[model samples]
Target: MKPAVDAIVHAFETLDPEHIDTLEALYAPNARFKDPFNDVRGWPAIAAIFRHMDVSLVQSRFVITERIVDGRQCFLTWEFHFSFKRFSVGQPQCILGGSHLVLDEGGRITLHRDYWDAAEELYEKLPLVGSLMRWLKRRANS
Candidate 1:
């Protein structure tokens, strides 16, 4: 399973539009994927999400910081780095998150669920919405 997970990590770290198809080999055909923004089944649907990411952002990559494997389940902590193609921040941004993956007997991922704070990691980084989101967060905290 380490090899499989390693392959997945390598693929994500070096992912690009041209090599997107290679990821299919790492997941089951009907594998399910869920994140803060999306929940979908099947390899094609999962691939679409990556495709959208490539189209919407630049210099995006995932760095897996830690991994815990127990039986057929694995939990990975990662940092997603990217720069918005639409907004020139002049510097990169990063989102801290984790993923819980369940693998089948063949080591193909059966379920891939990502956990992250959308409001903090994504929404609060936006240009116009950043201030509003921060204000709302402060209000909520108060």
Candidate 2:
């Protein structure tokens, strides 16, 4: 499982639209992927999500920071770095998150779930919605 996990880490670090197709090789046909905004199955749907991200953002990339593996499952911590294509300034933004992945005997991922705060990690970064989100967060805290 080390080799399989290693390959997945490497693939994510170098993932791009041009090599989007390569991701299918790492996931099962009916694999499940769920994140803050999407819950999808199958490699094609998963690939579409990645493709959409590439189209919507500029210079997006993942930087894996840590991982914990046990048997056929693992948890990974990463930072997603990118700049918005339409919204506001061109400052680099980073979303801190983690993922839980379960692999099959063949080393293909069967389940992938990403954990992150939409309000803090994404919505709060927008130019307009950012202020609103921050206010809401403050209200919730106080």
Which candidate has the highest lDDT of all? Answer: 2
lDDT by residue (74-106, candidate 2, tens digit) is 999999999999985588999999999999999
Q: Which residue pairs collide in model 1, if any?
A: none
Q: What TM-score, to 2 decimals, does candidate 2 have?
A: 0.97
Candidate 2 lDDT score at position 38: 97
Candidate 1 ranges with C-alpha deviation above 4 Å: none
**Candidate 1 versus the native: TM-score?**
0.94
Per-residue accuracy of model 1 over 1-142 as CA lDDT, tens digit each: 8887887788878887788999998898899999988999999899999999988898888999999988888999999999998875556999999999999989899999999999999988888898899999899999
Which candidate number has the best TM-score?
A: 2
What do the candidate models score in CA lDDT, each in turn? Answer: 0.90, 0.95
The lDDT, on a scale of 0 to 1, for candidate 1 is 0.90
